[model samples]
Target: MKIKLIAAAAIAALGFATSAQAHKAWLQPSQTVFSDKGAWLTVDAAVSNDLFYFNHVPLPLERLRITAPDGSAVQAQNASTGKLRSVFDVELAQEGTYKIAMVNEGMFASYKLGGEAKRWRGKAEDFKAGIPAGATEVSASESLGRVETFATVGSPTTGVFKASGKGIELVPVTHPNDLFAGEKATFQLLVDGKPAAGLKIEVVPGATRYRDQQNEIHLTSGADGKFEVNWPQAGMYWLETASEDAKTTLPDAKQRRLSYVAVFEVLSQ
Candidate 1:
């Protein structure tokens, strides 16, 4: 529910250090199964460019939440962080798909307009209203990162596909939990509840605790805001997309950006 806001001035102060290192957060569970009781799943989390490489670090519990099959909260406990990634555990008491998500709300501004770098936090509306009156030219991208995945126990369910009312959400056209290797999976990109077009989405094989890479496919959403991916192998897979509007709506920031991520496992033959 919180995003790290980057100000136009801050970008200059740091000399735009991390601009090239774009990252996406992901959640991976050790097991997806149903049980009578005492069923637990170990989740490995990280914000990285590669699957599970942990090159970017992991999200804290405050920014992470897991919803149970019955639409209840499933708390993650025993969290520990390292240089590349973090790990946690969650106990499941029901049979259905659980959604684990990491959400951040923030804005990015470019200092290229000259003068001092401006910094703003909190809501996006506040940043829009607070733009300096004297400012003539501004270039920036306000982004929201909505990263999530589904872990299903017993049989798969459709309840986990509900939108969280975030900026850009990936609504699975195919049941995410039912994916299998060598099959096709489709998803719709929802921008403010409607299908979004021309968005860029990437599908890649998830990283292991070590290192590996398979086929990485990049595609653009069609007129219907939908895209499909053919699962190559088994293990874990990552799907991500982002879109931005830079036309400046007025009384609002000059630019806005949005990003979405989803990870799921495919059964191997």
Candidate 2:
């Protein structure tokens, strides 16, 4: 089935305490593919950096959802969250691919005094604590962060790679779950359910050892909203893109930025 369009709604994020460093969410599994009849999959997740270990904190379970191998919704079981990490387990019931997605969006305000930008903060409840009394004006905007990944139990399936129709989605022209090092994979960027042309995309090694921003491959989508990249080595990687909207009428800001991220692996030859 093709992607169904859904309106990107703002999440009411109040009383959210965030770390100083920018936190990005990722999904890591004990094994990407299963060979046993009763294999179980374990996953560790967090809004973190420096590889799997948490640099920020764990993402709330309410923000996550999973689609199973046969395209049925699967609930993440035994979920737990702590200061450093979040872990969960999923039991495999089929022999195809499974997809997990986490989405978060909220309103943010930027403080400026005499045209000098001071700070930016999200969650309506943090406004008083974030903005100082001397601030002359405040601009408000909407923001969004999205993450997606896949795991398989035998051969990979394409059911979950279809766009979710909400943000800057990467629709794989080549099968995302069947990538290999040294092979070029193509993807189409869709912004709000339509082709997104001239968008910048970054493909970076997902490991902390190779995560220098200089090592990332940067590409731009063409008129067809498609871009291609070839992995230099076998490893997990992240593909991300973002866009800004200046049409927000929110009381706190003038513009908004939306970002999308996806994680996948390229197998060794």
Which number leads on lDDT?
A: 2
State the TM-score for model 1.
0.77
TM-score of each: 0.77, 0.77
Q: Over the stretch 74-138, how does candidate 2's per-residue lDDT look in tens digits?
A: 87888898887778888888788888777766676656777788655565456567777788766
Task: Flag clash pairs in model 2.
Answer: 139-252, 139-253, 140-252, 140-253
Candidate 1 lDDT over residue span 140-243, tens digit each: 55556667877777877767667766578877788887788899988889887788888877777766445554466888888998888888788888776666
Q: Which runs in model 1 stand beyond 4 Å of their true positions?
A: 1-23, 33-37, 112-141, 208-214, 246-252
Root-mean-square deviation of every model: 5.4, 6.3
Displacement of the residue 195 alpha carbon in candidate 1, Å? 1.5
In angstroms, how far off is 108's CA in candidate 2? 1.6
10 residues in a row with least lDDT, candidate 2? 1-10
